[model samples]
Target: METVLGIDLPTWWFLLIGALISGYGILDGFDLGAGAIQLFFRKEESRRIALNAIGPVWDGNEVWLVIGAGSLFAAFPLVYGTILSVFYLPFILFLVAIIFRAISIEFRSKEKMKWWRQLWDISFCVSSIVISLLLGLILGNLIQGIPLNAKHEFIGRLRDFFNPYALLVAITVLSLFMMHGAMYLIMKTEDRIFARLTVMANNTSKFFILCFMATSMATLIYVPHMTDIFKSHPELFILPIAAVLIVLNIRRSIEKRQYRRGFVSSSITTALLLILFAMGLYPNLVLSNADPQGNISIYEAASSTGSLKTMLLIAFIGMPLVATYTVFMFWTFRGKVKLEEHSY
Candidate 1:
């Protein structure tokens, strides 16, 4: 294994990949949540307001996903090829949903016809819901383990990816997104819409809290090796503890009417949960259910030392630029959305 600043190159890439995906989840999640609940807004102004809240920056948020996938290809081509092949069906649907989401955002306001707007509205909401659900399903399947052969091939059927636990995780993710979206809407709204979004935010938080608790218990009981690191190294228990504390603080901030703080807490909670998830898998990027030897550990699946070094250097230069652009975009679009003659 090659070391970069005392840490192995493969491990660094894994952490980088996890952080990038977590960034995507946190950034895109609120917009997805907002779209998921768009139909509930009733009035046309309310729906337009919710859409505008995320309009200026939703597309930029997806850049993280592109970077994540690109990094995986550069740093661990084997894992990229194998996991992607296994997830081919779901990924295809995910792409379709992405296309629909983009077009819905662009085409929704193109016409004034009620049917035209309704059609795009449904497309936007359904696409957002499916995208979020599919992301959670992929994660759940990864945590539960995929059936790979000795050659690192997926030998399982599609049904394996659609198990009950996966669906449960998907529901929990969707609920969390709803809560996150509600918080964003509350922050970017006023008067009646603000009150409505606030109430929904509270309700969604309750829903996610229950689902999260159930998922945690189910993982302990049904999912194997998930808590192995925590059980062996008691110190690692702090990760889950911190995650719980962050989740709890979300409600506290909401109760205090600090919507911005509440949203930040939720964002941190999302990142924390992802870190804990990465902890559960540790050295293994992709786990195998049938044979432990079939697992794709970070070292086993990483690129050559020279390639890793070169790619890492590029990442160091590139990621900061991406982060800066994201910060600038959000900062530029900060504060509540006010629709004018040319609003989304």
Candidate 2:
């Protein structure tokens, strides 16, 4: 039970894994958001510009998801195994969406035929929307708890994953991503496309705000237990408060025509929301509705202390490099997207 600053190693790994997942949500989120809004740009040039805006970084952004999944598998094998087994279908669908998105981006510009381009464009848009919804749906079910027997085995049917709460969450997530993507496009596009996306961003911003408020109300009214931790630890209330302010700032920033600031606000908002989620689910990787005692505690699900320690060191060395590369890529490609011969 190696401890860092009074917290145990498993808890640290839990935080690390959560951070990685949050990183994916923040980085890849904009990419998904961008793709989700793809079909909205009507003209061929507009679509190409939107696609090229994310071209240099979309695949790189996905690396965060890969690393996050790897961290989960390595640090909490039990939780990983149980979650994958329980939600196998959604995860597989998520993968398929990711693949379609990647291929659509690559293949869309390869042909001059209008039908071929349109087909891939449609695939890209649908896949992106599906991916965002699936991510939210998976998270929603995790929050609500699954049917796990005494042996920690999933006893629920696949249909059980599509509960009301999960559906609401999925739509909320889609709205959030759409807004986020609009902000990114506003930053990366100019002139006609810029004007078009500004209107889209404003509309999407309203959509997100409404969905967020609804989701918050639903969570508080129905899933009251999630707020229990905040009640017990009032200091943690700052996180949600900050999240609200940041979300508000997103709209304000956009209104002020500070597109980059709006994008940054959106990214921060994503991170904060994920942090709040992790805070609520702290110490429990998965809750079992069938058997309360069968809930997968982080302590029980974690790997050996030695393994956590070693991986922490590896993460320390590796993560910064990945982050640095991410920053470099964005810095390298910063500005309005231009369609050249080499552009996607």
Candidate 3:
């Protein structure tokens, strides 16, 4: 098949899938994080306020996840097959967490009984935490490179999921989500709930900074050739520098009780992380140290040129509409959530 505009179809698909997943992480990360932190509130009214704050937008945020998975299944079947088959356990756990959390969010508000609400709250919090950790672990595994055989299939055992580097990455993601959640709470709630969230943001931000540093150090030591990328591409250092600056700004914003500034800083921090991830997606999607020649470049993994052109046309028409609706929904729901109502 002739290449379209000199670019292969598979490469375009990979880029699309990557963008979708990353976007989902940035948007939904805060909501999940907020749900995880919901455990700290003792007052039923405060909990209601927290839940209501995210109620309108949480389900919409999940749309990006569905888009990402769908794109992978339709466009990059090989990558999807490998990931789903190899990471079966984590995948199942992630789905279960998402399901339970959704149920908890919907049911908690209907019940007037204290015990029933508490049970759902616990489910929501725990599920959020687990999902966030699993996402981190998946990223870690990808960067570390799964054990692929001659057929480019994963030969890794279940125990490999608990490796030290993977665990550190999971911690880093968990901390980041907590920080993101605190920022969302700062923006969505007011009065005593907002004040409490401010304190929570300050503490969580510090914890995340520590985890980020530890994860970076561990990745440097464990992932071979990763340091070389930094050394060779000195320009990439700007991303981490910007991330650090944003972290400091978040701290400053919290100190001044500027919720808007804090939220913006958190968003900037998330952007910086995404940039750093992009920096690592060089030469190939899955790098193999065992067989250097086995690296799966975007060009090699792509579909036919005709298929890519058609997909691009569809994306051009559909993506903008999706973005418009998402923005409109958030704008309509903008403002502080009150505790008087019990709906999520």
Clashing residue pairs for model 1? none
The residue-by-residue lDDT of candidate 3 on 115-227, one tens digit each, is 99999999999999999999989888778877776577666679987888888888888888898899888888888988898889989988988998888788778885665
- Candidate 3: lDDT over CA atoms? 0.80
lDDT of 1: 0.91
Supply the TM-score for candidate 2. 0.98
lDDT of 1 by residue, 259-321 (tens): 889899889988988888898898999999977778998898999999999988999999999
Least accurate stretch of 10 residues (summed lDDT) in model 2?
219-228
Worst 10 residues of 3 by lDDT: 287-296
Better of 1 and 2 by lDDT: 1
lDDT of 2 by residue, 15-54 (tens): 8888888889988888899899999989999999999999
lDDT of each: 0.91, 0.90, 0.80
TM-scores of the candidates are 0.98, 0.98, 0.93
Clash count, candidate 3? 2
Q: Which stretches of candidate 1 lie over 4 Å from their true place?
A: none
True-structure RMSD for candidate 1: 0.9
